[model samples]
Target: MTFDPTPPHEPRRPPPRSALGPRQLVGAILVLLPVVLLLGGLSRCSFAPGGPEIDPSAGPAVDAPALLRDAARLAPFAVRIPAVPPGWRSNAVDRATVAGGPGTAVRAGYVTGAGRYLELVQSDAPEEALVRDVAGTVPPPTGVVDVGGTRWVVYGGDEALWVADVAGVRLLVTGSAGEDEFRTLAEATLAGETLPAGTPPPR
Candidate 1:
């Protein structure tokens, strides 16, 4: 028998299918990860209109009286802790230097019985300067509201500011609380007494 020069013909095979390599697979996963996370986040968001409704009374209660006592000792001006009515809660208190000037600013925030927020800022700063700092800018007084015969100059519309000079310091009442709640806080603050002098705890 004659020996064949060429080997027997083999069956032709198709070329291998293209696929993502290790580096390409990692790159694709990286690109897809942010999109997946963003979609997940969007799915969890509320689509309802209007701003978020906050529960002002939800936070931890603070010892406003004790805080005010400490602030009174350190502050140049007297600090009076408001006798917040029943169901109202004090949420925060802070004592800091007046912005852009010398003097102390003692702030105590409260959540009213109706779940509205109000902040009282008693400062030794000048009326104009303190109001400017607290109000962010001195908008013209919208009007005036009387709290226990004390006249409080009003500023802004919806977000109101009721400011008055009581005893020896300026008291600013501002927040989401309604005019009535604002009046309540203002009245309470005005009615309250200044903390007694002597050795006091750190502010």
Candidate 2:
């Protein structure tokens, strides 16, 4: 038999895999990822709209009296602490500097018995500046509502505003409160009732 001059052909060997080096892995990923993404996109899926399920207006219940006392300690002059009617809740209190004065400004947010929301900004800032801050762009007062001896300028908008100066501080009351609820808050703030001057716990 004539010996074949060509040696037995060795089986073609695959390029050594190099134990899946970074380049091979990256190339494999580049090739397969698009297919995986296309498949995932074609699959029908549904989800609730993105946002917290909790109500935005909801906040932890706070002690109105305690908050007022704390705020009073922070404020140089007495800050009005309304005897919020039954079922009323105080949600938050903030201490700030009076815009143009040396005293402290206290802002308290309240939920009325009828579930109306409002905020009382007791700042020593100029009444004009404070009103502008509360009402954004101010129009000539649509009218004025008098609560006891204090007269509050009524401003109408998406959010209503009733502004006055009481207890030597320019007070601004505004929010989702109705006319009646707004009047109630104004009366409470201007009614001369104040938080006790109890010292705030050492902090």
Candidate 3:
């Protein structure tokens, strides 16, 4: 037998390290960098300080009597002796009265930084007592201006009292109604009264 001398075979080369090119690497970095930054920003925002921390009991205690006195001072006409109810806080006062005449009134008084009054009335008086009352609670009317196309007596106080007519419902008690509520009550009152055309509803 003839023994053939043969050279040893060479080993196969390994595959290329990766198919990613420089452009692909740059594109990936550009896309992923923004994602990483976004994640970091979201994490920082979640852990950031100075976020809203509310304590249900942290605010100043409400004083109803004090609110009533402030309301009296702010009201245009004298505040009839207010009969504050028990547990009333001096920082907030609301009163209601039904006179036997052509008027029914609802009043809300509050002192947030300063005094604020909101009143509703149905009467033929030149100025609605409720409007006067709220204006009185405010600093004082600088001048009359139109709000939402309706003319109102404006004032400067911590907050201003707003009055508008509500369209139905005969008697409404104060404290039970809000600013919009009083407006609704005033509108209702006007509809019931059926005043002459172009006559402004009682404030």
TM-score per candidate: 0.71, 0.61, 0.24
Worst 10 residues of 1 by lDDT: 47-56
- C-alpha lDDT of residue 41 in model 3: 84
Query: What is the clash count for each candidate, in the order shown?
Result: 0, 0, 23
Instruction: Encode model 1's per-residue lDDT on 1-203: one tens digit a residue.
Output: 99977668966665453754788778888999999999999997764332233465588898898878877777776678788788888988998887876667899988877677789999878877887788777888888888899989998844678888876678999888677888899989988867643337553
Off by over 4 Å in 1: 1-53, 196-203
Model 1 pairs whose backbones collide: none
Query: How well does candidate 3 score on lDDT at residue 142?
Result: 53
- Stretch of 10 with least lDDT, candidate 3: 110-119
- How does each model score on lDDT? 0.80, 0.71, 0.38
- RMSD to truth, every model: 7.6, 9.6, 17.3
Error of 2 at 86 (Å): 0.4
What would the per-residue lDDT of candidate 2 be over residues 137-181, giving only the tens digit for each residue?
Answer: 665678888788888887777677777876566788887766787
How many angstroms is residue 9 displaced in model 3 relative to the true structure, after the best TM-score fit? 89
**lDDT score of residue 113 within candidate 3:** 19
Descending-TM-score candidate ranking: 1, 2, 3
Better of 1 and 3 by lDDT: 1
